[model samples]
Target: MSMLNEWQDYLPDFLDGLVVTLQLTGVSLLLGLPLGLGLALAMTARRPAIRWPATLLVEVGRGAPALVVLYFVYYGLPQLSLTWSSFACAAIALAFTTSAYTADIFRAGISSIPVGHREACQALGLSHAKELRLVVLPQAIRVVIPPLVGFCILLYQGTSLAFAVSVPELLSRAYSQASITYQFTATLTLAGLVYGAISLAAVALMRARWPRRTPTITAGATRPPEPPTRTHPSWETTSERRER
Candidate 1:
């Protein structure tokens, strides 16, 4: 069969795999985001005991490759008597990586909050938790959202790594089909196209939804419209200038 025709035939299986891929992405994000926020808060805590351990976890997670983490969860954990399903293993590993990376993002967002705001909260006799819940976090959430969304896109693409653990995601399905048809080129090409199409569509939608805000220049915004050229100053008219 022609490659295009073959692609059409294989599309159904690929779509099934895509569903699994989305599920994995959603699960990882669901589990990771709150943990990431907690890590961010801990890393920013005044207590050294709290901050140190969370910092170490963030470092190790960020430093390790996702494949290694996946392998550790899927393979090493079994020996340690913590066996989990392949899907669960993949989700946990990916979620760990997600939380680690996102912790820094959350930290940056939280740090972006002005010190004056914190001081104002303190002056109002707000507890630390209340201040974060009411004032800091609300503002930080807005700052973090765009970056968080971008990271989510990265996480979605990274889900293909589950193929190593045999979780049967999009890439795994493509490889399975390629092995059977011996049409590696055609099968993989279709998979790449599928991934690219989804990613590009997401990017286009993100741009449409959150278009960059260009500064709007009104008539007096730049230089006060040159103060109307002062043809006849209110305090000194043309006749007054002649008299002077």
Candidate 2:
């Protein structure tokens, strides 16, 4: 009975925090995914000048811990005369992390294309840009949908780290409530259950949306199997007669 009352009292605040959480996540993905795609392309560029710097950025973003990155954006950037609100800092930090991590995912999807497809495009007189635009990317995106969805789930959970920067996300709300009511266990348990529920639902949706078969390298280009060879009885009899 008391637990029910506690939930009713705190649920509204947590929901407000959840709204913030979703906003932060949406903003980060909107900013991050395109940057991630660009980084993936840059990392795979033909020139070292383009590729090396992109590689370094990807490495640093992936190598650093998420909390450390958040702290760097929220606190450290102010030292360089660059300042932002806690919400902005959190969004920027998470977006940076998202771009770095998702770059590799995008790169793997792009690279999974069989070399033959690119050569075929070249033979058809398509420019590299056209080949990528018309052929490679469409297929790569289809191959990558499942992993991208999985990454989004991770990024959603990772928004909790923004609380350290005082972004008023879900974890921060739970902490604030716990501190005030001295009900750390109950408040935090509810917060965790909420997170779990959303994450599981996202995973279920991804599984349902994920393609059942491997996407073909190119549309309408599946190769048919070769016909089996068979010897006719007449041919076998002729051969036997010649042998006799």
lDDT of 2: 0.82
- Candidate 1 residue 157 Cα shift, in angstroms, is 0.6
Per-residue lDDT over 1-24 for candidate 2, one digit per residue giving the tens place of the 0 to 100 score: 787789999999999999999999
* Model 1 misplacement above 4 A: 214-244
Which parts of model 2 have CA positions greater than 4 angstroms off?
211-244
Model 1: per-residue lDDT, tens digit, 144-199?
77667767777888899999999989999999999999999999999989887887
- Candidate 1, residue 222: how far the Cα is off, in Å: 21
Superposition error at 199 for model 2 (Å): 1.1
**Residue-level error in angstroms, candidate 1, position 216:** 13
Model 2 clashing residue pairs (backbone) = none
Query: Among all windows of ten consecutive residues in candidate 1, which has the lowest summed lDDT?
Result: 224-233
State the C-alpha lDDT per candidate: 0.83, 0.82
**How does each model score on TM-score?**
0.86, 0.87
